[model samples]
Target: MTAETQAAPVVSYGRLVPVVVHFDDLDALGLLHNARYPVMVERAWTALWHERGFGFDGDWEAAGDFCNAVKELRIGYEAPVNRPGAYAVHLWLERLGNTGLTYGFRFCSADGAMTYAHGTRVLVRLDAATLRPTPWSEPFRAVGRELLRRAS
Candidate 1:
């Protein structure tokens, strides 16, 4: 789901993948360990970028600058699924400012019966070589805003 392929309504933020919490993903307390939430969010993030055509392949990086998200995330855990099932993560974005973009997510039961988690992430564009902050161009900005708007 790269920029080369226009985003469809179903893929406003790139993807909606189901995550099954394996037995190995739990802690002694039987709940999903807190550390796992970040990894979960990261899975969504990577897919979103790739679906919208902003992946971090060597060629893409070599050709142009990209966003390095400095995520300020907040995850709220709901029901405990020691043996978590197929949880669907609905991805969306909040807004895009000159320097940053905010992405939102709702990880819920695939059947929509219950919610597992909810959160948001902050990202910023960077120069390829220097890896410093840079303004995203109009086209990229448009794409981001469009996705964020639809999701919101």
Candidate 2:
């Protein structure tokens, strides 16, 4: 297959979480601050988690699936978000391992025709008490499988 075909699958899968770029998030140049990209993506992920009934609401044990730590993050900017408006962050499971998973995301226009930034984040599940890597719970893996991309 061609490179274009291979790269097109991500956009076809996963979910789109809405994001609003407020004026406060802009830099002096009137563009969304470079640092805000990850923050926005994080918020999107949090919202998704919440919608899926996973959150830290004083019950650590119940929220263990949301306790993963970022092992890696990579973002590539393709265009600048020049105005504060409605956009979207597309998220999909890239790789789901025993103790960790990698998510692929794109910060783009609401329709996803214009991509401002794209990246992947690697998160390692942790043992709440020991703070060490631990296998993902079955419930967590089940939810993850819904977002997991199928082989092209």
Candidate 3:
């Protein structure tokens, strides 16, 4: 399907994670620095993952599920964040595969009425020892399914 004709992915409110745009994240023009967008999103995702008990605690063997690495990221700016304040990063699973998954996200106003940016992030699960692509664990997939977008 053409870009214009493609259906927008459904957003899951349960996956919306609140984030703050700090003063340091702003540029001389008083707008959010372009480079900070992905950083902010990463922070949000990390927070979410931590909340779900996914993180490395100095043990390589126990960090398999959290060994995922970003393979690709694409963002489209829709508007500039004019000030440092409360915002949100809505996240949802776009595609889930054996060794990787694509996540859709939007940086938007707190109420989600205005989108500042939107994008997709592709991540590949990795084997803890080999540090190579590996299939995601069933537990990880189960958690991801909760944020997965429903088929239209």
Candidate 4:
């Protein structure tokens, strides 16, 4: 199943998305595969956009062919994730530039006892047709700015 979105009773460091660890996500060592962290983060990112009511169903060209594409991603593993269950992936807007957006993220255990990993991802708005970076739309920028402010 996809990560579930929930309303935070109190907004803390960032927004939280519920992550489900599938059986296949574990490595041979019985812990979450290191490479899977990025995948999980991507899922959380998509959920974040959807939660904010981003229109992703319309024609890409009509929307100026703008799409969010990861320009860079860096993840630091702090602890091993062994059990397969519900977890939380916290995400927040870190910055919004003319042609990019940065987001901070964290992976925590189900009970919040351990922090599995943390990282930052830089995303750029791209013209899908030409595969070139493009400036973000005013509406998109406004939403990003609001998220960043709330994160602070």
Predicted structure with the largest TM-score when compared to the true one: 2
Model 2 per-residue lDDT tens digits across residues 29-70: 999999999999999888878878778777666668877799
Question: What is the lDDT ranking, best to worst?
Answer: 2, 3, 4, 1
**Candidate 3 lDDT tens digits, 13-109:** 3367778788988999999999999988888788777878787787877887778789999999999998988887888889989999999899987
- Give candidate 1's error at residue 62 in angstroms: 2.7
Worst 10-residue lDDT window, candidate 2: 1-10
TM-score of 2: 0.89
Clashing pairs in 2: none
Positional deviation of residue 136's Cα in model 3 after best superposition, in angstroms: 0.9
Best by lDDT: 2
For candidate 3, report its TM-score.
0.87
- For model 1, name the residue pairs that clash: 1-50, 1-51, 1-52, 2-51, 2-52, 2-53, 3-52, 3-53
Better of 2 and 4 by TM-score: 2
Backbone clash total, candidate 1: 8
Model 3 global lDDT (CA atoms, 0 to 1): 0.82
lDDT (Cα) of model 2: 0.86
Candidate 3, superposed: residue stretches over 4 Å from native: 1-14
For each candidate, the alpha-carbon lDDT, in order, equals: 0.66, 0.86, 0.82, 0.76
When 1 and 3 are scored with TM-score, the better candidate is 3
Off by over 4 Å in 2: 1-11, 58-62
